[model samples]
Target: MNNEQRLLLLEKAKQFFRDEIVESHITRACAKAGKLSNYNVNPFLFKYLANFLKGNDDPRSIAEALVLPRVLGSSINTSFGMRIQKLISELFEGFGSTTPGIDIEFIDAIDGSKKYCQLKSGPNTINHDDVETIFGHFQGTINLGRTNNLNIGINDMIVGVIYGEEIELSSHYKRINERYPVIIGKSFWHRLTGKDDFYFELIDAVGDVALEVDGTKVLEETIDALSIEIEAKFS
Candidate 1:
């Protein structure tokens, strides 16, 4: 697609997230769980949410804030991580086919290689235990694929750390790294979009959409509405 078309699609995706995901899912879920109710409401939470909504220069923080509200309250206990995974998957689907699985499956357009992707938002998000567990599952999948004579294997898998610097890995992590290559930051985005600056372009596109949509106004209105509702419930 041309640059204009790509940007238009990105705008549509952001709007869909704001309307369908944030409004329909996150806001409603928070309301249902009484997140803004007097019993659960507090100045600190209010201030934090306000600050998050105000805006951040960091693209990752912007993306997270846009979706964080949806997973609050009862939704927090279920599907929180999955929700993020799905969002990332859908975002990449703009470039390639992102199929559902324990890890995301992306079919590279240039080489037709199917990459089974394990994504983490930050380096610290996955700890040593989490790495071991993920490696175990990934290894099992590779073995199962080999046993079934499938075309998938360790060569087709990648662990991507999205919004952080490269992590310091222990000996165990090093072994896992040897088996399944890990890519971080710019390399990860380059692999996904086959472009050197896809990450920056994406951030720019999202920022443009944010400005057009007046996200800060929407957030302020939302907070005000919720605060009034909570006050009414208490009064």
Candidate 2:
């Protein structure tokens, strides 16, 4: 995209995020700034008002909407949080003994970013990459795991099934062709949250639900790349 097109897309995305997340904060800040401006507005400081407005209305929508996860690693251990676990349990209950549980050790929450809940178990070993791939098929048949106390976020995620299977590490690596990537599609996100907002959709991309990440490799990579772009722009 050209600079102009990029800027336009950014504005549209920004407006959408502002409408969803930060409108109240912006309004309050502007109100306070306006009050100060009306009083003894110092000449040098008056110029800052315009700059402040520019900062408030950032051109990148994703950037404006981006909410960072706490860098200090944490877990969701509340009663309401486990509701997600229950949801997962129900989702996978009919899927032939697929036990899904959340892994609190690696939970990360970021607005406008995919919230990943690391799920682990025996009999099936679904790793991070596998989880990313399975979530691609939200509309189709999926078996979500059963667990209680899943945390809620602007976007939410849950744990699915994990079972171990014998594998030739060398062969597996060769099959990946130097790209051990997990692909998730936009359709899957839409199925999860029914919205094009990337972050919100990603939050719900877990549980007993399983999508073929390998099958949707191209689209998944595209979506992930776009996510990276959005993150960088916002950062």
Candidate 3:
């Protein structure tokens, strides 16, 4: 990519952080607090006493456990995971595949060869089932390529992780890594755009955009509102 494409990609990442991460999380949190945060305290204490008795649990923690865990987890695992793929596609002028097992389809930055990548947000993102699923998907991609005479190699099918060291990979990912090339963190970002510092730059972009969107203020307000709601309803 040239200078223009690089700038555009940077802007897009910042936009995603502001709109998707900050704004969307705030909206969802407020909505959830409004809906289910009014549970009766008597029944809640009667029913949830066991959960909070031996642990240092309060209404805030209890609420987080009940509502915020799934909400935040889905935002990171599904939403951010998806946007990262889209940004990588934008960087390479390619697209993520709808084809099973191939989350990313692009030409390598340094080598300029087509790559089929199974993308993950973290080293430990997959389970045993995901390992097997990726293996099957890679095999399918290879077979499809061969049928079309595209000369796709096993090495062309890789697993790309957004943030982690190779040694930090979980057993499931390690198993997949044994069968296919696994690229992580700085190396993975470098593959998308032939720049070693791009990973740190991307992190900086997110952090900068977060502040620009008043992420701190909104998040604190959301937490305070949630804590108060939970205390009123369940304390």
Order of models, best lDDT first: 3, 1, 2
Q: What is the TM-score of each candidate against the true structure?
A: 0.57, 0.18, 0.77
Ten-residue segment with the worst summed lDDT in candidate 2? 67-76
Q: Candidate 3 versus the native: TM-score?
A: 0.77
Model 1: lDDT equals 0.56
Off by over 4 Å in 1: 1-5, 20-82, 92-101, 108-112, 167-179, 213-235
Looking at candidate 1, what is the lDDT of residue 184?
66
lDDT of 3 by residue, 1-235 (tens): 5677667778888876777666666686445543453434355553365365436467555555544544556555666766667666655554668777688887778688888998888887778788788889999999998898989998899999998788898988888878898899988888888877888888887888766654455544555666677677656
Residues 1-235, candidate 2: write the lDDT tens digits. Answer: 2446434434443443344223322333223322222234344643344345345423232221221110001111122133433433333232222223333212222234433343333222333465335344221112231224333331344332222222322333233323322113332223333344543322333221122122233323333433455445434
lDDT of each: 0.56, 0.31, 0.72
How far does residue 130 in candidate 1 sit from its true spot (Å)? Answer: 1.8
RMSD of 3: 4.5
lDDT of 1 by residue, 1-235 (tens): 4577566556655765565455654455544533343234453554455466765323233323433554343354333334556656566564333333345666653466877777665444556677677776677767777887987867677776665445654444455578787766676776766666766766666556446543455444444555455455533
The better-scoring model by TM-score among 1 and 3 is 3
lDDT of 3 at 209: 74
lDDT of 2 at 189: 29
